[model samples]
Target: MNKTLAEVRTESGYTQEEMSKALGIGISTYNQYETGARNIPVDKVKRISNILNIEEKDFFVPLKFTLSKIKKDE
Candidate 1:
């Protein structure tokens, strides 16, 4: 199973504060990224990749959606 950005961070044993500091940003901003409230810049993503020693591709999560069809009577 794939994990979220927050999960990855926590699994790496780094707190939100530490990650924010390492990225030279505010804690709230980092939280927003993890919570999907804000979009992380490409450069920032690169920075995070370097910091976490993980590939940038790992950060991308594919979204799944289900669509329902309505039945109609002729």
Candidate 2:
């Protein structure tokens, strides 16, 4: 399943700049990640989880299996 980064951010009522600031990343970099133009780093992934008020594992479910595996391990 393909994930919708744009949808997630918008639904959380955040603009690219807000997300960038919250994650301590450049706005352009956050935009690229949301637009599928760049890969999101693992550190940013954790930050995104915090910003979106969701678990990191849930945030990544549609994009990967790693999150699920981590949850299982925990």
Candidate 3:
């Protein structure tokens, strides 16, 4: 899974403050988007994708996980 937004932000070496400045938004708002506390508008998502040099669809990569069966004790 490659949920690209946060990964791209880190890979680009931009702090939240820097990213917010680049996107013309407040740091708190950007943090909300990054932390999933707020849903980022599509236009903002596009701007962030542009700043990170990635396509907006890259943000949709799903997280990987697995479920295991638990055994019952007799």
Candidate 4:
């Protein structure tokens, strides 16, 4: 199974506040992204992937699978 953004962040030992500051965004905004309440922009996604030391593709593959599954279900 793929790890979530929150999982990766936690494993990397970063608090939401710290991540928000690093991203130059608000804590609420970061929380929203982590909680999937908002879609993170590609630029920010790249920054996040870099910060987490993971490939940028990690963020997108799960979403692609989910979208494809949803389409198939519909």
Candidate 5:
């Protein structure tokens, strides 16, 4: 199954704060990317994928799908 950016980041054992620091971006920006509130630029996606040790395409999973999965789990 495909994973959301947040899921992949959590599995990789990095908190949002740490990820933002590593990416040299603000926590809010990172959160926006993870939560799909804003479109992440390709360069930033590449950096985040590298940090999480995931393929860049992983971030392309549809946000609605991810949200539905989360709701189901809850």
Candidate 6:
């Protein structure tokens, strides 16, 4: 969750337009979700996880090495 959805989506190679089409949602709505302007629903998050073949918890994983730093601090 430390990583923005836009960052993840891009790294995952999903364009906003493509994700919108795949999720049967509007582009603007998807944009809002990606930009953190809107809170993503659990069902949509699940669908995204399924589409990316990643676990829902993975979405909560920080990609910026913050977890590693915390572990080292411990």
Task: Give the candidate number with the greatest TM-score.
Answer: 4
Please give the RMSD to the true structure for each candidate, in Å: 6.5, 8.3, 8.6, 6.7, 11.2, 9.7
Q: How far is candidate 3 from the true structure (C-alpha RMSD, Å)?
A: 8.6
TM-score of 2: 0.69
lDDT of 1 by residue, 12-36 (tens): 8899999999999999999998998
The candidates, ranked best first by lDDT, are 4, 1, 5, 3, 6, 2
Q: Is candidate 5 or candidate 6 better by lDDT?
A: 5
By lDDT, who's the top model here?
4
lDDT at residue 35 of model 4 (Cα atoms): 86
Looking at model 4, residue 23 earns an lDDT score of 98
* Cα TM-score of candidate 4: 0.79
lDDT of 3 by residue, 1-74 (tens): 55546667888898899999988999999998888777787788788888888887767533445889989998
Model 5, span 1-74: residue lDDT tens = 86778888898899999998998989999899888888887788788878877777656733433434344554
Clashing pairs in 3: none
TM-score of each predicted structure versus truth = 0.76, 0.69, 0.71, 0.79, 0.75, 0.69
Local accuracy by lDDT, each model: 0.86, 0.78, 0.79, 0.88, 0.80, 0.79
lDDT of 6 by residue, 5-64 (tens): 777788899899999999899999999887767767778889988877778986653233
- Candidates 2 and 3 compared by TM-score, better number: 3
lDDT of 4 at 36: 85
Q: Could you tell me which residue pairs clash in candidate 4?
A: none
